[model samples]
Target chain A: MEWFIAKIFAKYNYWISIILMMIGFYGIVAKDNLIKKIIGLNIFQTAIFLYFISLGAVKAGTAPIVDAEIIRKGYVYANPLPHVLILTAIVVSVATTAVALSLVIRMHQEYGTIEESEIIEKSRDKGMTWT
Target chain B: MIVSIDLILLFFVVVIAIAAITLRDLLSAVILLGAYSFLMALIWVELQSVDVGFTEAAVGAGATTAFLVATISRTVRWEKK
Candidate 1:
């Protein structure tokens, strides 16, 4: 029991990320409004970013920026690779969100509503068949 | 000490997330989401990923919020019951 407690305490960050992931997943799956779904998607992406960054953390580490004295002491520095990759991911996320929102706007123009069920109903009313 | 603070921030993030989804007003939800992104950026900084945090603050909180608000303005601001 003590060992289990020790392990859990040491790895609490992972648990927090998992909880966040579940919340985002629920938002994406259960929400009916298009904007809410998009918000959920963003939350999901943020959770993944958090998980990746937590993975890169080193105990007693400083930021990855270089300094001679730090090198001389053999101090650990946080991994730069995940930071670089997540930077790219953030850019991609922004672009994706822009495109998605634009598409939502277009859909709203067509269907006259942003609710998923309403869109379906409107399309069906217009004699549009869903496969 | 830092771990405790991170945990508390994580709890707040979850609460804000729930509020963002459950709120009735679309505008409120969008604003809450922007707040969520800002908090997430802070968490990244706490985790020692300053670059990611900076990018998140700009892209997640700033650009994303602007994009969402603009879209909302062009479209409807309330979800149908």
Candidate 2:
């Protein structure tokens, strides 16, 4: 039973990551509100982060730090490269979110509504008609 | 090692993602999205990506939530639905 449970858990983690990514994608594509779109974008980006971090896991691996005792025993440790890459990715995601939010705010001020359909309608009425 | 905890975490992530996107209320969606991020962070920690987990907790669960709430305050809470 224990082995079965472990196998199930390991398999389910990957599935969960995939489902989160898809849901985030759906939100980004289907949501009408500008802010909700941003939320979805965040979700999508976070799902990728989760995926990458999960990929870095190594069972029974120690921290990447080198200790004298572990060196003597010649034991391997988990790689820290992925962790460093993810730190950079997180910063990039935050910067992107900030810029997107700023644009949304500007759009709201100009159109007075953040709904994508309403914005399109208003633009059409104004003879912009770029939809 | 029983992996049921990981499965439960995955389940929570899925449920929160669904709630985040399907809700008519924008605030609710934002909150659920934050919850989703937090669960993802927990998964990262379980996977032994402490640095990534820290960043996810900080930016995903923290700043993103703040930004969404602030944006919602400046706009309507729900759509026509």
Interface alpha-carbon RMSD, every candidate: 1.3, 1.8
lDDT of 1 by residue, A40-86 (tens): 89988888898889999887788899899999999888999999999
Model 1 clashing residue pairs (backbone): none
Lowest-sum lDDT 10-residue window in model 1 chain B: B1-10
lDDT of 1 at B5: 73
Error of 2 at A7 (Å): 9.6
Q: Candidate 2 residues A2-104, lDDT tens each?
A: 9988887666556666777887788789888777777778778877776776677676666677899998998777678878888898889888988998888
DockQ of 2: 0.56
Q: Residue-pair clashes per candidate, as listed?
A: 0, 0
lDDT of 1 by residue, B1-81 (tens): 278779888889989988998887899999999999999988888888899998899889999999999999999898878
- List the DockQ of the predictions in order: 0.76, 0.56
DockQ of 1: 0.76
